[model samples]
Target chain A: MRSRSCIDERAARKAQPALRKVGRGASGRGHGNAVPLPGPASGRRDQRRGMPPMMRWETRDEICELVLADEPCNEIGTHMLEALERFVAEARKLPARALVIRSEVRSGFSAGADLRELYAGILTRPREEHVPALRSFLDRIHAVMDALDTLPMTTIGAVHGVCFGGGFELALTCDLLVADRTARFGFPELRLGLIPGFGGIPRLRREVGNAVVRDLLLTGRTINAKKAATLGFVSQVVAPGEATDVARRMAAQAARFDRDAAVTAKAFLKPLPREELAREKEHFVRLFQNPCVTEALRRFVESKDVRPYLP
Target chain B: MSDTVTRLMALAARRFKADAAKLRAEADFFETLGIDSVQALELLSELELEFDVEIPDYELQGVKTFTALAERIDKRR
Candidate 1:
């Protein structure tokens, strides 16, 4: 079988000159001078003149940074998702044997879907307009997850602080996860009267177990990193500031293996069958009939404590 | 090295920069090559498929280098 690593390496090498040209241009412009021009202009410049500002590659380590540097309130906006997709695609082309992906946020990894956008879409727009917009947003999120899943290289998710909803789902797609002891993880979509539309339920079920997945989806409660590690959701729990280092170490070790075999094995261990997915969808449709789900939603909306059953 | 091992090692070195040429028969997998836990798990997953052997998570942290990994594979063989 052809080695995926070789294919990636070749592609990266072929693209190196273009990448370097962009790097030179960005450096020449001076970071401070690169104001947030109009979105279209900045985006065009990013595509034509160099790499996107949010993504950076460390060739020797086979690591990439997907930073969520926009203000915390801007979480899960259209621009962020676009940047994530672009970075993930570019990272897949890098020659590295394995890849380590870490969030660049200090306080929280990500705040899940942008609530402002959601509220505005539902309240101000017609259902026809709102549903398609929501679906498009979900599709973009799925694209990011799919890219992470399909990358031939082994991928590590190094998380800290808070990783909620879509951010949590993104981490679930990784082959391995490393988190700080105090990091928080959860699927808060239920509080908004919605499901985790970005592949969270299926992926979480595959990683942890069906029972835990049920509780999380039904209750939308957050869990600490230690608890996540204990439940086998997190692969490793490190000291507060050590998640990235641990992830890098893990990536470096994984890089030693035959990349083709790695890719094949990951593909082999994918989630349950299509029939099973359909059955799960049916159950989800009936979720409103369940007293537990309804009560949980009520309590979540009423500002009552619902933490006990969330994990 | 066997052809299979040689090719695999070359791929690893090229991608990981682990200096396969410097690997000794008894070297520790992670210690010698700076393999962290996540990378070790990924390597374990790859090895399991390549050799059709189940190298459990508990055993993954113990193996440190390609040479040691080869010995383990040899034993499994």
Candidate 2:
């Protein structure tokens, strides 16, 4: 079998040029999306040799930027999960004052969970082990999300294109979301016969009302960045390819404030919905046990239709 | 064709760099323009921006031609 990193590298190379073009007309600086580089601050090729395939982070001007650039779209599979875990670990040790999570993939921020990988796992493993495996993955992801959510520094999600399911959930982990006009946000898990297992529900409820949450979850319909802004979930709606730039500025502003005071204000303003999050994981695990989920994922993974992403 | 369909066809043609005169209101856009999923999404974004309306992706399910898409946009308007 081929290694995961190799596949991601191939896709990264294939997508690099088009990804670069997304920033061309934005600011004339042409740095619309920051490509992931190896090492903390030094741009050295040697340090890149063993870097993770899914993402990479670097700190500059006291702001740590994590760029998600894997594949056709950054699907949250084992590779992404592990990469995120590594990010949290590195982030905690960094002296950075702010964090910005963005994507360099031209297709979007992310399409969501790696449905193909999930389906393959179901096929290879025993049925009895499925729930346990899912539970383990959820537990690990939730831990990472919780850490990011409660991090003292202000975190911003600079999102564009498709931010659905787990991807949207990942964005919600940030303190604020800055979306490009082309961005579309949704929770399409209902189409897969499951709920978003990555704490999307509770996190979203923290940002918006229940009616908005219900519409997204029940309809599985995507909303444009403009609609998302009106719904009060996205903090800023920017021109195409400018989300990262806007987020970086926001991070800069955040850095100017007293770090301890900012941290305290964030803690006071945004409390984690611990109970709802725990209940959500249980509901997700229970829903994942249905055989229909496997079939739904299989169809999604194997689909050749142009609108497969459309729920 | 209705005016909505005509305008929708023209918008799609311009965005995709196709000949506006050669495009038809009733043509299957995905087939006519040779677009994949990402381009289809770009078109969706362009339409939402063009029409100033939110036509949910589910509403466009099975909608292939500019005429059908125009109807959905019209309804939302």
Candidate 3:
């Protein structure tokens, strides 16, 4: 079987020079999207290592940064998920004072799951044939989030571009959310006839209250960074290119504390609340088995038109 | 390490999924226990909460063994 890591590495190496170019994607001009490494961009060698080098992990002083600096849409996929798992494991051991997660993908933080993978495979296949795979995938993703949510150190999500579906849920896991003006957050799973499968609903409800959560999930609507801030979740909303820079500074400041105190404080603020993560998977798979879901997702994959889920 | 420490470490090793028998006073994490950094930190945090003593990260930086950890906690207590 081909390892997901190898598949991701291949994709990373295939990027054009423009994709790996450092400092500010085309959208941010020179001030945007800092690549983790400084060099001539040896993505080729990185690919040889059989892992996506785009999603980078870095530690400076006592601070660690996990960057979602991917090309095109930086869509979340199994490979990216695997990379995050490895990064979190390492970060836990490092006992870093803070972890900053940010996306520099110009198109969006992520376009949710890799629509191609979802559509071409599960959506197009017989529901019974693919349900097991989808269930396994969601379970692994939840495990990743579980590890992330329980990390003993502080976490900041520096969000930019489109944070949709699972990607949006991933950002919400952070202790603090710092979004760029260009950032837009939403859950588009309804369009594909599925719910946010990664414990997003419970977390969203906790952050934004019941009514707003209903509006977002039911309508599959998106809110810009300013509106998100108004909702009382975003810690800071900055100009187009400043989210990462601001978030890093926030992390640096957060890192000044004694580690144990920070962990205790976080635990006090957000106790391990009862959640229905397992149920989310059960519901998601049940929904995915519906003919409506399969047809909707198939149509999405084929045409990319997104009108079905809208209210 | 004191016998009390040996007992404490036995519990800590269980939490870390490590063998308590290999957890020697002088084994020091990297040299003897071979506990990964993450496991070591896990043990530290578990111990801190267990003892209700805050172990500073600086103190943990050079700590290498079960004995060292016990000594640090003793000083704090």
Candidate 4:
């Protein structure tokens, strides 16, 4: 096993593992003359303090935990989405046997996209502008999700309470899901009149079957971890706060096998079809462009009310 | 305050689209900007690119105010 010693917070704070390309030292060519001002969270020059990173990578014993700091609850904003993709790429570039995705957020794995941003940006824009903006946004997001899906390494989603909408959609991309018993899993997107744009529907269909997906997607109700386990939504349903540790253990075991053989086996189990995935994106875009859907999203934002879909 | 600190604060105010004079050095980022985790990360990313310094997410996890942000950036520099 590849073992790693604990990274001292004081010392670790000084290193920028993700940005080594920029070059590190007492003085760099850019961002001239930064004075040492250690705050609650250590930061490189050119940043404000007292805020948490949306996501971080911690590598040890050949396993990397991409943690979503609690302060943020791992919400995926446009920038957060891009950062996640970048971080994944960097981790893949590094030598790691397995990847475990989890969150340290007290509330849950992630709260999904920023509703404030979504409502503010989408509502203010004119109706004609909605389709183009949404199309580009969906296209970019689909790329990020595709990045996670395409990783050669095994990935696990360690889920806890309140994984809804985009967060739930994200967890579906993982090869294995180890959910906490108290976890709540659901797609609340119907409330916003938008269907899953990041391949959630297809993944759910494959994992839980069409009937189950229909029930969950149509009703917009979340299931507890136990129910999800029985329904095959999760492989392991452990006690509260044990999701991340269990996932790590599982990743270690997976990493123990011959890397090539494991990868080949994974490829065999789910050979993702590019054509189908592309179709999924198109479907989301078309539906979002529909007048009814746009009107619903706008109404939801303006009134903060949920009007049940009649169709 | 150092020039670096003043500039960093100003940059943050602009990114958050808030009034520079109104932003307190000690205010929590989420509270002051009314932005979520992802937006905050975007601000960090913007700063990194703008100043050409690397601010790892782990290092900025506890930062919530202008003062802490300046301190964190200073340490990295």
Of the candidates shown, which would achieve the greatest TM-score relative to the real structure?
2
| Lowest lDDT 10-residue stretch of candidate 2 chain A | A27-36
Number of clashes recorded per candidate: 11, 0, 3, 15
Better of 2 and 3 by lDDT: 2
TM-scores across all candidates? Answer: 0.58, 0.86, 0.66, 0.64
Please give the DockQ score of every candidate, comma-separated.
Answer: 0.01, 0.40, 0.01, 0.01
lDDT of 3 by residue, A86-119 (tens): 6666667774788888876655566566554454
How far is A245's C-alpha from truth in model 1 (Å)?
0.6
Give the winner by DockQ. 2
Model 3 scores a C-alpha lDDT of: 0.63
The collision pairs in model 2 are none
Candidate 4 C-alpha lDDT tens digits along A1-311: 54432222222223221111211111111110001111112145323123445466767777877776633344454545556666755766656678898887765776565443344444456667656766676676777777776677788999986576678878887889998754666676665556666677777776887888877777665566666787997999887689999999999898898889877887787666567667777776666555665465444334411111111
lDDT string, candidate 2, A1-311, tens digits: 11111123422222222111122111111101111111122223242244335676777777888889765667676556766777787677777889999999887888777665566567766777777778788888899989999888999999998787888888898999999988988887888787888899999999999999999889887888988889888999998899999999999999999999999999999999999999999998888788887687656545556556442
TM-score of chain B of each: 0.61, 0.94, 0.76, 0.85
What is the fnat of candidate 4?
Answer: 0.00
Sorted by TM-score (best first), the order is 2, 3, 4, 1
Cα error, residue A96 of model 2, in Å, equals 0.9
Q: Interface root mean square deviation of every model, in Å?
A: 16.5, 6.3, 21.5, 19.3
